[model samples]
Target: MNIPFYKMHGIGNDFVVIDNSVNSISLNKRRVKALCDRRYGIGCDQLIVLSNPKNDLADVYVQFFNGNGDEAGACGNGSRCVIAWLYRKYHRTEFILQTNAGLLPAQVIDSQMVKVNMGQPRTKWRDIPLKHEADTLYLPLAGEPSAVSIGNPHVTFFVEDLSTVDPVFCGKVLEKDPLFVEGANISFVQMLDRQAMRVRVWERGSGLTLACGSGACASVVNAVRRGLADRHCQVKMDGGNLIIDWDAENNEVLMTGPTSFSYQGSFDLDHYPL
Candidate 1:
């Protein structure tokens, strides 16, 4: 079967998006992994599938699969890209996207920019679903990183100098730490000021990527909790910058960034076995 796919990216985190609403393409683990393989397949940080909404309140249902073919609860940047895709089809600015994480509201800021409400950050150890009870504000780790669940688990480490920290080395070591039962996205953050910070992330299942949207949101939330940064701050990643605002009154995190359409094409499913 030939499958039509869209290549889109928010910041530098790219995705291969498929409209499964009508076709209802069945993608097993092997196919998902193959589609995300840089050398063999379409190549992307994650694969996004759009289907008819299961929830009445949502405009569409979005499922995210990492490069390793594991399903993830939520993806901030990916959500914006999905919204952008929908905007092109419906020509609507507002949308409700249903994911494993829950319902997310999104708005198209422009042709190439979008903003998404990532919902609330879960701070409790049990909510983050750590192996055992530990302080979410300050985990008992070498760097004393803070843990938060932005639909998915993430641990943010505030470092003094980002140049000195190797993200790949630290991310690999910490992503599967015994403390995180479900594995975690690792972020090393260097505070540039009270309102700006630099971050490098190791995304769970996807390894290193240009950007991690949820990682940026988690970083800002953790920074606010620690009084290291303001509620609304700028998170600079390898790809670009994102504006994250932790709305205290709403108890929600809003992420704003740019999205792009690299191209669109179709591929044969027979190339990837089940």
Candidate 2:
């Protein structure tokens, strides 16, 4: 069996995108995991399946999955990549896409740049799906973790230095700690200045990854709530930099970043037989 795909990336975070709109392909957990395997398949942090919108309310619907095979509600970078793919294929300047997280409005700010309205950030423990009840701005986990939900759950831990902390150890412990039932992307963030910070992520099911856009957005929102950072800040991840802004008046968060297309091709799925 063969399938068509487009490998795209934003910063260093990458995805394997399938045009399910035209191709009759169904993504099972095992097949998605197999395709994302670095050694045995096309390596990627997540797999995004793009299908035609189910109604006039949306232009596209994205099904997202972590490399570990768990279905994810939303992904910021993946959303941007999907928009780019749609823009490139459909030549549209603006569009609305439906995600597991909810409706997302996206537009091409310029060639290779996109702005995404990622909706509101959830700060309540119930909303973030954390077991403990408290202000999400300050929750006790392994370290200083701020629970915020952009599209999915994220625990942003602020550190003074990026080099001092060990992500492998911290990320593993905090990701599964009973606080977050569905697990969370752990972000160790170090403030560089009032408006900039360095971030590293142990993505929920993907483990350590180069970047996480939703994580970045959540971190800024947490920082602002805690008075650590302003409403607009730059989150520098391993992959690259992302600008996050929260509009208090409207209760919406906007993330802006650059996206890239690595290449386009069809793959033989025989190696990952379902």
Q: Best by lDDT, which number?
A: 1
TM-scores for all predictions: 0.99, 0.97
| Model 1 alpha-carbon drift over 4 Å, by segment | none
True-structure RMSD, every candidate: 0.6, 1.2
CA-lDDT, candidates in order: 0.95, 0.87
Looking at model 1, residue 239 earns an lDDT score of: 95
For all candidates, what are the clash counts?
Answer: 0, 0
Pairs in clash, predicted candidate 2? none
Give the TM-score (vs. native) of candidate 2: 0.97
Q: Across residues 19-135, which tens digit of lDDT does each residue of candidate 1 receive?
A: 998778888889999999999999999999999998999999999999999999999999999999999999999999999999999999999889999999999999898999999
Cand. 2 Cα-lDDT: 0.87
What overall lDDT, based on C-alpha atoms, would model 1 receive against the true structure?
Answer: 0.95
